[model samples]
Target chain A: MALELLKERWSSAINVLKVGAVKEEGGTRASAITVGGQTTLPFLLDEGGMPHRPVVAMEIFDVAPLEWPVSLLEPFGDAVKDPVKWAKKCINEFKADLICLTLKGTHPEAENISADKAVELVKNMLKEISTPLIIIGSGDKEKDNDVLARCSQATKGENCLFGLAAQDNFKTLVASCMADDHCIIADSPIDINIAKQVNILITDMGFKPEKIAMHPSTAALGYGMEYVYSIMERSRLAAFVGDKMLAMPFIIFVGQEAWKVKEAAANVADEPGWGDERMRGPLWEAATAVAMLHAGADILVMRHPEAVATVKRSIDSMMKGNND
Target chain B: MLVIGELINGMYQNVEQAIKTKNRSIIHKLAKEQLEAGADMLDINAGPHGADPKETMRWLIETIREVTPAPLAIDSTKLDVVELGLKLAGEGSMINSTKADDEKLDIYVPLAKKYKAKLIGLTMDKKGVPRDKNVKCELAAKILAKCMEMDLPLEDVYIDPIVLPVNVAQAQCAELLDVLREFKLISDPPPQTVVGLSNVSQGTKQRSLINRTYLVMAVASGLSGAIVDPLDKELMDAMITAELLLNKNIYCDSYIDAYRKR
Candidate 1:
């Protein structure tokens, strides 16, 4: 039997975004980070060029988490309460590429912190860390609109990545990002159509496409990971075939979703086979991140320092000989 | 889809008047309106109303140039008028057409190379408008062969399988779509395909309805561009919705506006 070689050709490519603008480019940071611009599937080094490596962003909170699993809480120790110190630990100790400062305290059901308080906390975090910031607000639509707008104003020209501009509550956040010249995260609930629609709506307002990232909601391994997997795959495929709306770099909320799954951190006192919850949680998070990387995730928001390290090691290894 | 707006052609009453009087305002207004209505390029034909089409084409090019930098389609059967339009319209101008036959291609095909302009090649030959898919496909292949021999890039070449009037050539309508689908197989990197879209609806009472429905069918068959009226709102909407359904454009709730923006 004779084997004939046939190569697949792609008409379009995903757009690369240089997210955090440094001082020379009008932002205060010393460095900028670029993501996306993959012509082929992720880590398929032989297929095409992956111009930028996938970077890890460790999620920090404006207020301390009261319900974090014991496995997650043990690492931060006392630094969890203060946002600045928490951001510093992600950068200084854990070597996170970016810090995603989520204002979880501003949720109406939670602490219900005012916009000013959230802004103030952000200002403090900015003063403390030089790693690029991805500022996200509480999931509550009304509260996020009020809080994120103020936060955007405080970080004007800093070129921070602000996000979760969902379908129902995008206007205020989009306006804030536009006015401040910051990047936006277009979020959808694991649906490609919704993801594409949100992107189009934002771009229709004259928002630059490169100043956007996609957040197709993620689920952890052994917990509907297939849904997240396929959505991301379809999104990247569409982008490769020249769908501009879905071409932005993907930002998977790895830490939040992966940790939330029972397989990652569930206390297994009843089942002897579920052994060693400590190692299991972070390992689950890492495995989930690795699979997502293969499925075209461009940014990973992760917790569990060990999990972050494991993901980082894998990225470094995969990215080592990527020249085609 | 590449929309070459048809409104600027002097066959229209307003354009005819603009050509005769050399009234830059009337011509510029038409050019600006068509551009705003989402035309990628404007077809500047001085029509039968012009005493000297070459002078009229030059006038239109000069007037439109003052307002916008959108590319112009140098539309004329006369080589001199087409050449003058190209001269004034500059680098990105498109030759509105040439037939597959040697008599037309000998002149117009080289003009595309000389000026580095995009060329549109018609499927009809000396025998006249193609009667069926076989003739259309055969003519397209002949044009592709000519383009190759002349060292012309197929990427810049557009194959136009002429759209006949539905009221007359009803039997040929379905076959035209088949020709459009088969055009890609003529070359590895297929030449782009466009059609004179309104011709499909000529003499029909439901002109807009037939034109749009046929345009969508053409689009589904891999037609890449068309010379049509951008100002036709329903027609433009149908084209955009078809593109979205065909996955040519990304989906958005406000996709119509977004498609225009893109």
Candidate 2:
């Protein structure tokens, strides 16, 4: 008969997945980052436990340059040419929680670089940075299958997070991650069914479900970002209520989606309605990353340091009452 | 869970008024709400409203069909009323009930076969519900046998062990689980099991708690369908969690959301 007495009893808790490795664990990272062990919705420590905070991973391209919008490139400066330095700068300067080494050059159409080149870059970045590593392959399906597999093997014992595996191209990457004791990023189109099916398929391949991270294809804020938000939200809700298949930590390509959108890079001169170009781009990225985080993104792959700092502060302060 | 939404019945003021006034909008609105809340089927009952039961069934069917062609469970003790609703309903339907009496099964089985409608056979016979699990199972097998003899596929038969109000029949609660499990062994292609879930908490203070707890336990006992209120958020949440624990559904973080989307 009373409102306060109406407390609900949630039956199942989300399964937690720990990514990254440390020295004792046979890797060089400063610490392991664990996510997805929430007993309630994000930061609802009132309802249940949120074992891990949303982590921010500063993305560094292996090849760099050529295509980054000036607003984005302005922050990194000379570090653009070398990945090892770029990754180191993200950790040492921005205090990035993790380093996501994007093997952009390995895409067949981009530089047509060989898998050997990507492996070398991964090794160098791992050596240069103390933060946990998350390696992302270029979007090309066939090329990513080869590049991610080889890179996964090259850093075999590091317990890194490596993937971007689609429904058709997951086997090689899944096998590599399974064999190497690394985590996976099971990427699906912006659809729940496909996202769930992909996770099932990856697990069906004998890979443990907890070692997977979801990349339910997202879009930037102005460019249909709500679809990504809903998909991720749904995935998390399912996980909280006891769906182990979709219970993996979510890894959103915030930087990738945010930077590619026209609004993030559009110049004020081109569209006078948009105020300053410098502030617009980073703010756009920050806004998108923040949205993804609240929508149950466990790890964010972000670009701008200012945006990274903003999102990190947002994550830190968001869990204020939870006693994280 | 085959949620047969308990709305769209004349028992509620809105639906009673809708049935009396033939207000298609109100019936359609409830139908949509139930479906949105993840009901697999809608139960069309011309509850205590002031109208001819047959005409009320026809009107309810027309109102529901106007918006969506969702499956319906024609709920009424009157066989003719259920038959009329089943005839007017656009798609598949489940006859809300028939007791395990041979006379009732003889009539209901032929009607079910002729209309291709599924039947919900209660495990209570002329003597009323027996508290014993074997007694309940025997009645269920009697109904299952009649359906088999009539060549009505066993899959189309859903056996309800007739849940008793826990406040009075608390002793029957444990036997309910035993009866459900034994029903699976009654026939090959095993008749699906169902329950009028809310009946378990008929006069109980913790109605929602009792309904969901009993539903989850019944699910563990292989209950395939339940006549439940789709709008009961906590009840639905508990059922979703139960399926996940049973490993019937692949686990997802947003399981309730994903289940709702489905």
Q: What is the DockQ for all candidates, taken in turn?
A: 0.39, 0.06
Docking quality band of candidate 1, CAPRI definitions: acceptable
Q: Model 2, clash count? A: 18
Model 1 chain B: worst 10 consecutive residues (lDDT sum): B253-262
DockQ of 2: 0.06
Q: Judge candidate 2 against the unseen true structure and give its global Cα lDDT, from 0 to 1.
A: 0.84
lDDT of each: 0.87, 0.84
**DockQ leader:** 1
Top candidate when judged by TM-score against the true structure: 1
Tens digits of per-residue lDDT for model 2, A1-324? 666744444656666778788888888878888887777777766777787788888888888765888989988999989888888889889888888888888877889889988888788878877777998888898888888888888888789998787877788888999999999888888987778878877877889878888888879998999988887777677666555667778888889889898888988889899888799999999999988877888888899999998888888788785323
- What's the CA error at residue B144 for candidate 1, in Å? 2.6
Per-model TM-score, in order, reads: 0.88, 0.60
Docking class of 2: incorrect
Write out fnat for all predictions, comma-separated.
0.38, 0.08
The i-RMS of candidate 1 is 2.3
lDDT of residue B132 for candidate 2: 78
lDDT of 1 at A228: 89
